[model samples]
Target chain A: DQQVKQNSPSLSVQEGRISILNCDYTNSMFDYFLWYKKYPAEGPTFLISISSIKDKNEDGRFTVFLNKSAKHLSLHIVPSQPGDSAVYFCAAQLKYNFNKFYFGSGTKLNVKP
Target chain B: DVKVTQSSRYLVKRTGEKVFLECVQDMDHENMFWYRQDPGLGLRLIYFSYDVKMKEKGDIPEGYSVSREKKERFSLILESASTNQTSMYLCASSPGGGFNEKLFFGSGTQLSVL
Candidate 1:
């Protein structure tokens, strides 16, 4: 069973526009949600994260919002750039098991200039 | 900065061959993980270790085994390679303080089995 799911396999957006990538999870025990960005021939790198206690967290142009009641979260990038084109993965970490994380099938984001 | 290094960037192995993929971390992290990335499948954990000589099976550990003799190094072994096992293997490490620490990943090794 996939604990985390990214329904859209791909997303395309124009540069200088807002881009939103959605993710859903089935488990309520997850206390922390994170996003990772990966480029071709490279491993994923951490982007931003939000704790369950907070509904939203922002880091410069990258912001993450969590909705516990719906078991869903979304990452919003303001003024998307061409360099932001890559695969974005949503991950959830169990409250007790900090060492283990569940990841969703990534959504490939293409920013067209 | 924490650096996780996979021994090889690309490897090609034939079926029935015994394969070993090596990973080393410079941060002396207590937790290490091995995950495989496949198309539309995301990153699935194969195995993880919390300490030296200790390991735990992840969601997909059927055809794979892991060894962590030291805190800085983790190895993934394929007893018998198969075509189905071909994919990108990634190694990651994180500190072990029970905190929500982000995982530092290696560049990944693309293993192709013929």
Candidate 2:
């Protein structure tokens, strides 16, 4: 069973528009959520993260929202650019198990310029 | 910046051959992991090591083995490579004793079993 799920396989948005990627988790034990971005021929890089204690966390143009009640989280990018097109993965971790992480299948975001 | 390095960017091995993928980290982190990425299945954890000579199996460890004789190096071994095992292999490292520590990943090694 997949603890983390990104139902959307792909997303398309126009440049300078808002792009939102969604993820859901089944396990309530997960207390931390993170987003990673991967480009062609490269490993994934950390984007942003949010703790379960807070509802939202923002960094520059990226914002991560966590809804503990629904076991859902989302990544929002404002004014999306062409360079932002890549595979985005949502990951979660249980507070007790810091070494293990659960990752989603990933969503490919395409920004049209 | 923490750097995780995988030995090869691409590898081709014959079926039933023994394959070894090497990974090393420069950050002196205590945790290392091996994962394989498939098109639709995403990333599946194969194995992880928290300390020298200690390893644990992850979500998917079948047909795979790991070795961590030293603190900075971790190796994934395929006892008998099969065509189905052909995928992108990634190595990651993270510091110990932290809650939700970020993982530093290598460039990944694409292994093809013919």
Q: Which candidate's DockQ is highest?
A: 1
**iRMS (Å) per candidate:** 0.8, 0.9
User: Can you give the lDDT of residue B11 in candidate 1?
Assistant: 99
TM-score of each: 0.99, 0.99
DockQ of 1: 0.84
Best by TM-score: 1
Q: Write down the worst ten-residue block by lDDT for model 1 chain A.
A: A92-101
Chain A TM-score, prediction 1: 0.99
Instruction: Give me the candidate number with maximum lDDT.
Output: 1
Clashing pairs in 1: none
Go through the candidates in order and give each one's C-alpha lDDT: 0.97, 0.94
Chain A TM-scores, per candidate, are: 0.99, 0.99
**Per-residue alpha-carbon lDDT of model 1 for A21-77, expressed as tens digits?**
999999999999999999999999999999999999999999999999999999999
User: How many residue-pair clashes does candidate 1 contain?
Assistant: 0
- Per-residue error for A9 in candidate 1, Å, reads 0.6
